[model samples]
Target: MSTNATTAQSPFDPDKSRIGRVLCFAAHPDDIDFGAAGTVAAWTAAGVEVSYCIMTDGDAGGFDPEQRDEIVRLRSEEQRRAAALVGVTDIHYLHERDGYLEPTHEVIRQVVRLIRQLRPDVVLAMHPERNWNRIQKSHPDHLAVGEAVTRAVYPALENPFAYPELAAAGLEAYKLPWLWLFAGPEERENHFVDVTAQVDRKLAAIHIHVSQHPDVEAMERTVRGLMGQTAERAGLPAGRSAEAFHVVTVNGPGTIAGF
Candidate 1:
């Protein structure tokens, strides 16, 4: 039940939470790949079903707006390919206008419907806290999506009375109490799934975002470099290339349900 960030190198283990269905919510096409692809690969390899829910179409993500529609389409295709690489079959795009995502009731309801229908065991989302001082900090879209997803994960999905029409569709009330919020203010993560065996697969999956290949490739190098630095800072072993996460257990005494 504690809220803290932890590195991927930690020996901490999660409980046997059946992770048969996982839904990763990201603001844009590349967010999930950059933030948690390695872990996604690990989960998929273990037979966990993984899906991506991108909040935005990423129209404002590219360098050119003249080709906004085309860019969005291309980005979506890239995301699909990337999902395939990671063994995910379903990819849902909200197509919300890029760069201006607000946590509206409508958006929350939509996410809630997906949660109910998918019945995901694990939901991965960005940290919603704002960092005004850090000008180059997290994107506003990311923050908004995080907030909406968190709210929806609780009341929206569990309360059958919340969205009546969804219940009519046979999407019954469900609760996904296990959540992993990345890039939180704190840096002590609670659960760390070993991605050492799937690091290369992660890199390959990341490479599928051709529109961002250059920048992502550069970022990959930086991440690899930072791994050593992070280990030094945390006083852990060196040469560790890991992705960090802040886990939030909404239920079950902080236990992961599936293996």
Candidate 2:
């Protein structure tokens, strides 16, 4: 593995950055932990504020249908604990029932409000586009939430006139500069954040989601392997680990963006 991102560049693309506030939206409680918690830890360590805005309680994630209410409470607590491990205390759980999310105007309105209120420099969300390689796990809820978040970030949140009600309520439009999409198709310009130092924190966070992953040790190993694979693809050393993201310039010039 090598660490020569500059040498292989074709043109200017979004680069890996850790700055300001970052708002992450996920379909379920464990989605961010499973996909980008290491990167989140790394960002927080850099003094960046991170918030988790989850769409569902993940009550339908488990098979034990009889314990729905209990599972909901347990999962929410677990997610909070997991997020706190990485210095993330702002966790918003949207009460949409699991497995029934739709990319409707209502969903976009919900996320747009958060986007305007939080006013984050960067937004992290699941990829709205389906990845052919991850066909099996591209759940409908994930797709819907992803689409909603994406819609909110663009013309919806940035356009002051798009939602007069939010503006009337003192939630000003926020022109988000960058966005990072996880679990999506990989490209040459994608950013791979080296999270070698935060792997322990990330694994610990994942461990706290006990309801989702009961075998902590197995989850740790799997996470390490996945991050290591990302590092290898980014041309890093064998022992190094990374969290991958496909970042894009949203409302700003790609070349001039600070990130």
Best by TM-score: 2
Candidate 1, residues 53-116: lDDT per residue as tens digits? 9999988876655656699888898888888887887999888998999889989999998888
lDDT, candidate 1, at 41: 81
- Residues 45-98 of candidate 2 have per-residue lDDT tens digits of 767889999998898875566667699898899899999998899999788989
Candidate 2: list runs displaced more than 4 Å. Answer: 1-18, 63-66, 254-259
TM-score of each: 0.84, 0.88
Model 1: how far residue 113 lies from native, Å = 0.2
Worst 10 residues of 2 by lDDT: 1-10
How high a TM-score does candidate 1 get?
0.84
What's model 2's lDDT at 128?
A: 81
Clashes of 1: 14
Task: Give the distance in Å from residue 12's predicted Cα in candidate 2 to where it truly belongs.
Answer: 8.9
